[model samples]
Target chain A: MPKPERIDPTDARLLLALTEHPRATTVALAEQSGLSRNTVQARLASLDGGAKLRSFERRVDPTALGYPLTAFVTTQVTQRRLDQVAEALAAVPEVLQVHGLSGETDLLVHVVATDADDLYRVAGQILGIPGVERTNTALVMRQLVDYRLTPLLRRAAEQ
Target chain B: MPKPERIDPTDARLLLALTEHPRATTVALAEQSGLSRNTVQARLASLDGGAKLRSFERRVDPTALGYPLTAFVTTQVTQRRLDQVAEALAAVPEVLQVHGLSGETDLLVHVVATDADDLYRVAGQILGIPGVERTNTALVMRQLVDYRLTPLLRRAAEQ
Candidate 1:
């Protein structure tokens, strides 16, 4: 993870406006933030250039699309095969998000499968991967929230 | 809860492409799709208008930035307090996402806090809110994979 880029008050204001509405044009962003369109445009370009801002995106429902199985898989890798295990796990297309973590779980994996049968296939397949110590899985009974960069960006904007 | 808005293969393809690279111009989409840029643009316009392609955004990490604690708070509200509960939960600035889900959990909530202490305090504070029943939380230790929208969108473009 890289360091969070420094931002100004105006950048903060821009972030807030965008989190609620990511696609607001310069004109709209400026109008909402009380800045001129040009200024907003310039700042947007600069912020993006500075890596403080990235692209915008929409939120979609994965389940609605027939991917009914979602789970968070925590892995405890053997001391010898940790790196290899992470690499193999990261290779899967079905795995949505992977992160290295602390505590009993060295890595956490989130995967989406078409159904329980699909999930079973994935688990069976992954269990055979080299160096995997153990796995704990939590099937999502429901997805309260999936992913959105906006909220954190908005919070950063607030600061 | 609403119908999974009748979406088709072409629409899904378009979404997958845009979700992968929202900045990809209509010309590229046209080239990739063997369609006209004007047509691609037009379809995108309709999707945008319909709130299908609301906005594009990148999902970042809160833990990487020092907010290490993450939890999913499962909430249930009586019929009478449904609206009240939803509204109150949404008001909590720390609440990143609030959603209605299936199975035993009626609602799912995602929250980010600086640490366990912060998470505890925030969860307790939220419980203090009227109509919030006992909350169950599972702290995330790590992320193994993020099946983000972008990659799926990219695959759609390739097809």
Candidate 2:
């Protein structure tokens, strides 16, 4: 991770506005955030150029793309071949997110598939990786709260 | 979930272009997708209105907002009080995502905080939720692969 980039209240307001209306024009954002159009534009440019904001692609829903099933697989891997295991896991298209974790689990993998049968194949592919000792897979039945940051942005803006 | 909306090859290409250049203008998207400007506009509108595409807010990094620590908590809950548990978990600002899961665990919560001590408090708050039986928390040491969708988008376009 890079050094934490400090965002002022103005920037937080801009981000919060964008969170509500992502495709809003500069004029609209200015109106919503109560910031000058020029200020909004400059802040957006800085946030985008500085790598503080991620690309829009990260928001794409796999379920919308036909992969409705989501699962988390915790894998224990052979320590010596960790790098190889990570590389292999990266090659699997169904694997959306992978994290090296502290404690009993070596890796936590987030996966999505079109259906249950496809998920079986995807999990098998993950286990087939040479360094993977074993995997405990849990199917996500329902997402009560999807990934969100609106509350944080609101608090930041208020401060 | 709504009926899965079918996206044609053109839509896939348009999404792929957006994945690579999220801030690209309509003209740029039209050029990259090899579609007419009007077609690009229509496709984008359809995707957005249908809720197939997510807003840029989903891409915001909690770490960038001063919450550097990431942890996954698997919570076991009493079956009948699932809704109450979900509601309580949603009240926690640090809890980014909560998913009802199959198998032994009843819920999977993704959380973020400023530091280890903050994470401790967040976990305790989760445990404090009524009907939450027990929670197994694991701190994410390193994100080998963050959430992504380009690979799937590219494959969909190719097909």
Candidate 3:
């Protein structure tokens, strides 16, 4: 990962405001942040131009698309074919996120399925990948806490 | 969890188009999906009204906000105090997402930290939670694939 750019407290405040209202216009953001309209626009431009911002696709939920079952698959793979394994996993639509980790498990794969049978098929598809050796699937029974960043943003702004 | 509403191919097409261009105007989505503008607007309204859509906050990357290290902490907690444990975990800004899983580990916690020491602190905080029994941390060395939904959206459209 590239060196993360440190966001100032002012930036944090703006981000927090934006988090509250994602569709907030520049004028509204300026009003919320107590900054000039030009300042808001310029800061937003910088944030957008930098690596700080990401695409809005993550807002869409897999469950809404009919694949409600969520599972984490810890995978062991052949070291030599690691790249190929990732490539193959990418081709599987059920596979949502893959993270290489430091530990016994080589990769952590996030997948979603429509049902138990679909999950089985998705897991099988992953294991059949060229370098994938083994996988342990743990189905998510409930979401104790949904994905969130507001608290962190609050912390950042406080800092 | 509520019963997931199934999306038809037309809805999938519109969603897939939205996934590609999150800020696409209603007319643009209609053109992209070869559907009437009114139809696109109605479908989007329905999708937004239902439990299908999620907040856009997931688009904000933790790394960009000065927390570069990412780790998944599998936590075992007192079954009876699961709700309290989740509430305590939410109070800690570093704890991003937590899921109750069907496995030996009761909860999977996603967290971010500024560095190794910060990670240790975050882990310790989680372990200190009233009901949190044991926690295992797995540091993400690399992101093989980031969170995505376009492929799944395409599959839904094709279905």
Estimate how well candidate 2 is docked, as a DockQ score. Answer: 0.75
Give the local distance difference test score of model 3: 0.85
Clashing pairs in 3: none
Task: Single out the weakest 10-residue window by summed lDDT for candidate 2 chain B.
Answer: B1-10
Highest TM-score scorer: 2
Q: Report the lDDT tens digits of candidate 3 across residue range A41-148.
A: 888877766777776567778887888899999999998888888889888988889999996348999999999999999999998887788899999999989989
TM-score of each: 0.69, 0.96, 0.89
Worst 10 residues of 2 chain A by lDDT: A1-10
Best candidate, DockQ-wise?
2
Task: State which candidate, 1 or 3, has the greater DockQ.
Answer: 3
Error of 3 at A27 (Å): 2.9
Candidate 2, number of clashes: 0
Indicate the worst ten consecutive residues by lDDT in candidate 3 chain B: B48-57
By lDDT, the better pick of 1 and 2 is 2
- List DockQ, one per candidate, in order: 0.31, 0.75, 0.69
Docking quality of model 2: it rates as medium
TM-score (chain B only), all candidates: 0.73, 0.94, 0.91
